[model samples]
Structures are given as structure tokens and as C-alpha cells.
Target: MNTSTHYPNAPVAQPVARHTLAVIVDNEPGVLARIAGLFSGRGYNIESLTVSETEHDKHISRITVVTSGTAHIIDQIKAHLDRLVPVHRVVDLTLQGEALERELALVKVVGKGEHRVEAMRLASAFGARTLDASLTSFVFELTGSTEEIERFIKLMTAVGLTEVSRTGIAAMSRGPDAM
Candidate 1:
């Protein structure tokens, strides 16, 4: 006779659909490199990455990264990052709680008379500010979600897109909290 445990009412493990990680690290040299290396070395992909000095006196920087992976991979990534020397904290913004995400993009478009006017009009419609202007070129500054920035870029391309630069993404948890 069989005398083994026969409890078959357990739930299966599911993979995480998406994740946003917010990392607080010392604002020192090689910090970004080390973090990036951690991702590349382990074959993880970074959909978006944004970093900036949040506290000047404390010399602390915040890095917001968007990525997708299974549940196991996400835990692995967090544990690995936490073990880094420069990393002060590694938080999974998506799983831990609610957060706000934003990004800034500077889109440069070069066009002739009509296209130039059209580009400006489109940019205005998208709430993008014209940071710079010339007879044949214009630089529009836009800040919003990644989807919004992508929409603006797609529209600008139709009007004669020349170049674009994005400041990645910066995110933080909502409410009375600091992470």
C-alpha cells in the first residue's frame, strides 16, 4: 500500500508579467557601470533605465528600470542587485506598491517651410514645448509616460524627424514615502 502524502490542492507558480525596479545607489563613479554589468552579465534585459542624483548632499542617485521577466528571474535580479557594493537599496516598485513614472525627451526635427510649421503645430498639440528653433530645425521638449513620448516621436517622424534624445525614466512610489 502507498502511504505518501496526497495533498493536491496547491496553487502553481506564475511568472510576473511586468516589473519596475527603483534603485537607490551611492552617487559615485562606476556605480552605473556595475549595475548595468549586473544586468548584462546575467542576460537580463532592461527595457528602460533612468538615473539622476536625487540627493546632492547625501550623494545618492535614483535609478528607475523597467523590465519583464518570470517571477524567479525577478527575485534573482533583486537579490543580486542588493548584494552590490554601491547599491544602497533595490526596490521592486511594481510589486512593493504604487508609483509614478515619467520621462523627458528632446526630439529634433529638420524640415522645410511647410513641414517646419506642421512639426511645431503637432508638438504644440502634444503639449511639447519648443526648446529651440531655427529656419530648418526645431527641438521640442516633452515630458510624460513612455507611451506618450513614443506617440510624439511617431508623429514628429512623419513631419521630418532628424534626431531624438531621451532621459530614460524616473519613477517613485506615491503617497508619504521615500524610496
Candidate 2:
């Protein structure tokens, strides 16, 4: 170990920041796939994606996508999404204020005896529920912010985590007005 007292003030390599985009679009087949293709074709990566019908009659759907890029690239993505015929609007929720983000994940763990007991105890601490359970395996349902979910998963991995299925992030402004 070099004991030289030297401290360099070099800037760290900053990865592109993440932004959550909420897209309101006409609910139709192939729309989600199209949007995904647009990102993949352009060498962009989507960290999380969720789509659901917010209104009845299935006329409209909300697509929430979590992605990271430079400011200019993010702006370009917003513009391109807006140009899609089916997309009514694209809102960068991260740029907006006071947004509430939540996600649901099903984490499966397989273990025996103490491992199983420890898993349940840990899951309880995280407020996760057993959606499915057997002697050798358990499927836990957890809902929370991204960080919370990630932490829970990390803990589960050490306790015999088997797999996970996430519903992505659903976010909205927390105010009287709708986004």
C-alpha cells in the first residue's frame, strides 16, 4: 500500500443521468413494440417500461419508460416520441416536480429450513408478501420505489433468490392537476 499523501481532484466519469418519461398514447396493438424498437434501433437503452390503460373503454394508455442519456439525447427522444401518430404527448416527469414513482416486483426464492425462515423474516422486514409459497420455494410480491426494490432484491440474492419479474415504474405528479 502506497502511503503517499496525495489526493487528486479529478472529476469522476458521470454516466448519463436517468429520466422517466410518461407517454400518453392511443391504445393500440404494436404500439409498445414500436416504441421499444425505436429505442433499440437507435442504440438507446430502456431501463424500465410499463404500459397500462388509465382510462376506460381502452382508448388511451400510459407508457412509462425509464431511460438514461445526455440532456440533448433525452430531448431528441422526447421529440421523436411526440412525432409518433399514436402518441398524444410525451412528458419528462423527471424534469417536472414532485413525481411519485412506484414499481411492483415478484421475487422468487428457493431454499430450505433456516434459509426459508430467514427469507420470510427478511421479506417481512421489507413488507413483501408471499404471493405463492411451497416447501422449497416462495414467490414474494413487493412494491416500492426503485431503490427500495433494488435493496430488497440484493438482500434476497444472498438468501437464495431464484428469479424476479418486475412491472417497471409507474409514476405521476403528486398534485391536484393531472399529467
Candidate 3:
């Protein structure tokens, strides 16, 4: 009898880490579904997802996915992504030191008097640009790291924040290398 040491069904007890993966894939129909399915079917949660065609002539799209998982799970995810027909390459941007990440957000605040002044002052302090302003409301545009955006939104809430729309993180490796 052969002894088996691997337990496929065993629960994993390991430290989970947040990672950002950039997948280069062909721009085609159903490609996004397949990528999303890979995560959904495996019970992996995608914290943030951004996809855009980086090469128009080549019909290639770059998909940036942020997720949390153990190291083993992350390796498995990368392997699976690499096996996809449309995927050309999978790079773990989190592992690449000094990767740059940024997001854009539009925040709308509704208030008058002190609230309005305070909100504008807060926005100005954060380098948020006023996109629109009226007697009762102002829409501000801000772009920065995710943490910065979160902090700005939280402070806005105290100053009559009414709505916010965000563009998911757009990231890339810094310096001379291209992922």
C-alpha cells in the first residue's frame, strides 16, 4: 500500500497577506468572466479590481487584482492565472518592491455655512480639487493612494459628505522595468 502525505481537504492555517497581482491578457469576450470566475469559484475575495487595455494594436489588457490569501493560496492563484488561455503573464506586484499605486475619487459634500467652509478647507488641505460648487453642495476630486483616499473620505463624512465615487487602483512597477 502506498502512503499519501498530502491532504487536499485539510484546512489551511497560515498568515494571510494582501497582494496585488497584475495579469496581462488578451482583450477578448468572456476573458474577464473567466478571471472573475477563477476567484469566485475558489472562494477568494477580490478587494479591488481594475482592467484596461494597455495595448490597442495588440489587443492586450492589464488586469490588476487585489486580494488577501496565504502564501500557498497566492501561489496557487498565480499558477491558475498563468494557465488561463488569455493570460500572457501574471506578475505579483506586491512582491515587486516599490510598486506604485494610485486611485482617483470624487466626493460630494452637502452643507452650508461653517460646514461648507470646513469642507472646502479640508479638501484644499488634502489637495482635492473642487470640481463643482453651489450654494449648498460641492464636488471635490482627489487622487492619491488608497489609504489617503480613505482618510479623506472619513474626514469628509464629518463635514456632510453626501456621496463618493472612486476609480479603482491603477498600479505599476517603478523604474525601468515593465510588467
Candidate 4:
């Protein structure tokens, strides 16, 4: 072991920050693959990814991605994505002023008696709707911010949270301008 002295002047790593990116691209084959390839090739991890064709006539699709990295790395990702042939625009929603973000989650809980009552009570408090219910299980539909969904899930774990399915974040700037 080459024991080296620690240097006080060494550079400190920047804090990793999570950001949401709204990518508009041509609704064609291989476009999504290219974007995925870019992230995978760079060894970047995406926390959440949502894609849908927003403009059917214009053949444009919107891709919402949540990722974490240092500020410089985030900037690099935006720049690289802008260069893709099919991509029309890449907007960092988090950096953009006052973006509204929301996610939809379907939470399933299995229980009986008080567990059932408690689940319903919690869901009602969280504004979650009962989508499906049976003799021993129930599926609740909740739409809220990611943090809220997480909190709800955490609380449900003690009651009877069996599974969860989330529709990744969908975000937009508060202004009227299109992204």
C-alpha cells in the first residue's frame, strides 16, 4: 500500500442534484433508443422516464426524464441531447422557473378489518381514490407530487402496502410558453 498523505487543497465533489428534463423529439423509431443509448453509454442513471406522443399530427413526442448528477454533468447532458438529430428541444424543467411536477401511482394493499379501514382512511386523507377492491385487497389511485406519494407509501407499509405502480413524473413550466 503506497500510503499517501491527504491534501487539504484537494477538490471537493459537488453535491448531486436531481433534475427533470423535458425532451421533445420526432415520433419515429430509434429516437427513444438513441436517447436511452446516450444515457446508458455515459453511465448515467435515470430515476424516472415517461414518454408519450404529444403532437400526433406533427409527429412529435415528449419524454420526461428524472436524473441526478452534479451541475456540470447536468449541463453536459442537456448539451449532448440538443445535438441529437431527432430531438427538437431539451428543457431542464427543474432549472426552468416554477415548474409543476406530478405523478400518478396505483397502490395495492392486502389486509382485512382495521387494516382495511385504516387503508381507506389513509387514502381518503391523501386524496387517493379506490380503483379496485375485493374481499382481501384494494387498489388505490393517488395522484400527487413524488414526495407526497412516497410519504403515503411509507405510511401504508405498516397498514398493508403490497405493491405500487407509478406513472413517472410529468412536468411543465408555469408560464404559457411551450417547452
TM-score to native of every candidate shown: 0.86, 0.88, 0.92, 0.92
**Candidate 4 positional error at 92, Å:** 0.9
lDDT by residue (tens digit), candidate 2, 116-152: 9999999999999999999999999999999999999
Clashing pairs in 3: none
Candidate 1 lDDT, 1-179, residue by residue in tens: 45344656556678666789999999999999999999999999999998889999999999888888998899999999999988889899887676788889999999998898899899989999999998889999999988999999998999899899998878887888766
State candidate 4's TM-score. Answer: 0.92
Q: What is the C-alpha RMSD of each candidate to the true structure, in Å?
A: 4.3, 6.1, 4.8, 3.5
| lDDT score for residue 13 of model 3 | 78
Off by over 4 Å in 3: 1-12
Candidate 4, which segments miss by more than 4 Å at Cα?
1-12
lDDT of 4 by residue, 84-129 (tens): 9999999999988768999999999999999999999999999999
Between candidates 1 and 4, which one is better according to TM-score?
A: 4
Off by over 4 Å in 1: 1-16
Instruction: Give the C-alpha miss distance for residue 75 in model 3, angstroms.
Output: 0.6
Q: Candidates' lDDT values, in order?
A: 0.89, 0.92, 0.94, 0.94
**Cα deviation of 42 in candidate 1 (Å)?**
0.6
- TM for candidate 3 is 0.92
